[model samples]
Target: MVLRRIFPAMYTAKDSEPANSKNGTLYLLRCVFFMGVRKPPKRYFLAYCLWSFALNLCSTFYQPIGFMTGYVIHLSEFSPGEFLTSLQVAFNAWSCSTKVLIVWYLVNRFDDANEILDEMDKRITQDSERKRIHEACSLSNRIFFFFMSVYMMYATNTFLSAIFIGRPPYQNYYPFLDWRSSKWHLALQAGLEYFAMCGACFQDVCVDCYPVNYILVLRAHMQIFAERLRQLGSDPHESEEERYEKLVQCIQDHKTILRFCDSLRPVISGTIFVQFLVVGLVLGFTLINIVMFANLGSAIAALSFMSAVLLETTPFCILCNYLTEDCNQLADALFESNWIDYSKRYKNALRHFLHNLQQPITFMAMNVFTISVGTNISVTKFSFSVFTLVKQMNIAEKLSKTEEEVENLY
Candidate 1:
């Protein structure tokens, strides 16, 4: 009975959802058989993931290529403000490139990613703990739903802008190609752009939400683990041998949890770090754009972009930070165990367990940046510093140009 309680049934239904995570984040893979799991027979879901990946890859190149082409062909006619606007789009494309990389990472590492869910399903067997896990997923799903909703709306806005408003978001992406010569060709390109748009929308949604969900799920498991620690040795009817077995089981549980973390670190490190770098640079550009553009429209747009960025990035930062707090509380939870009343051997085993808990499980990105609010906070500080340096250089460059003109006049 104790063994049953400790290890799960080891059987997963053939048609169970790919991400038994119960979170809306990997909604992209919900279509058909993905990685290894079978789902509803609609293969379009997988097709869409592929479709989005391809178009996003094209767009990832289109943005910078178009911008650079303009600089080369129209260098004499280039306006700094126009270049800035295009540069912003180029940066946005750079973001798409990173997203593409993340999507590729997630798809390539799908099984390892699923282990997180498997671990949760295996360990969270008790009814009360299952309820708590469900609650945590519900909360996380709501937050991610909000994030997805905002992004989808943004995509909808872009769609409307391109189709109805006659303003393509990535205008001139096909420079030197005349779309006006043939209405049929123009319409065809528009349709293809729409396809690409769907790809990007799906890609961004998956990349942004899953890492945060992974952190939240890990946090929930840690909470349950802590509760288990606090309950150790509390049963009066169980024999001494039973208590020893349970303690051994608890040690195994801790080891499994750490292994889950190890699996997760590789899965998310690239995604989250790439995400942080992209968002940080865009945030920096947006900040500088606000000061550089005194026009009311530009200001409002910059503020809106900044808000969308924070909405997307903030949850990952906050939740991952909470994971650290959960780890910190494990030692206390072990102390809450009724170890004082146990035999010396049991007490000694618990002592070793407590010592292992001292190091704590922290999610580090590329094993460099500690994945937490502190790391995110540093990204923002770095953004601000870059913003300052850019502004100073712009001012100094203008001053130097003026001085040269004055010397020429003299």
Candidate 2:
């Protein structure tokens, strides 16, 4: 109920309901851009296509233009700190574009995603321990939304700092090389950047949140299923046949959850892979820039960028870890169930279910790397290593210059 209150459109079963029935950042986006149209209207589709094209084009060219102009053309004048900062910004923009592309690919499957959510809701609400499940879902939603709010504040601060405090007049901080000759032109460019950035952020948050919500719901259902399995033989009045029937039902439920996870994987896998890749570079570059740049504005920008990257990557890893753990525990839960008292046929079925559970049910990033807390740790370590290497090179370069000056003085 609390989940429904917080995310009515997300939790609601009816697709026909007006998008305005729910009110939240993500729900509003859905209402305006994605909801109710199995096939988006031609105008809407064209608008989305054009917007995505512009965003991707900016992401694609921003880095190369900056590299050529700042590093190649003016190599002697380019400070290492400035170069790293530019690189970080470019990577951040590219990451945002990747998020947009992922959402674009997945948007058409919004109805299927909703059906999974609706199924999960129906199953949980009908469970015997519905209250506990509801509480868990509520807590999860609260934590998620709280993180999202914090991220929004951080993004806003960074955006404002970049606009008013960091850049010179007529020189926009966006990756573009174009000159805005007038205040109004600069304002318009900034506005467009804001719009594109917000759209990218919205898409990333919604895409990540949907899978997380589904994982939480599936976890609740699995818990209930395990409990039901354990209670199968507790009721002495129930006949063996009835118990066996319940066992079959539990098996069916387990299969359904697995099926749901399978369906959800493809929608998120490539996005997750790209996120991991981009975040690694972003984190490393941000760290290098933060350490090298002593100015307040640069520090704030780097910190903000780092926070955004961590917020995006950390929760997804945590949720994936939980999802994996919940799935792996299924076998143990089944074994704990009162299966000994059931007939041979029922035990056989239980054994088969347990066998199936032994195969890992995990979310993969592009089917290459598994999404887990372990992977997050590895990525952090790698990023840190990169930062350390860069720092050492910087120190060595300064030391070499100092030695040359000392020799000249002698």
Pairs with backbone N, CA or C atoms under 3 Å apart (clashes), candidate 1: 52-199
TM-score of 2: 0.77
For model 1, what is the error of residue 168's alpha carbon versus the real structure, in angstroms, after optimal superposition?
3.7
User: How do all models score by TM-score?
Assistant: 0.76, 0.77
Range of the 10 consecutive residues with the lowest summed lDDT in candidate 2: 16-25
Taking every candidate in turn, the Cα RMSD to the unseen true structure, in Å, is 8.1, 6.1
Cand. 1 TM to true fold: 0.76
lDDT of each structure? 0.61, 0.60
Question: Which whole-number lDDT from 0 to 100 does residue 287 have in model 1?
Answer: 75
> Cα lDDT for residue 302, model 1?
50
* Residue-level lDDT for 44 in candidate 2: 78
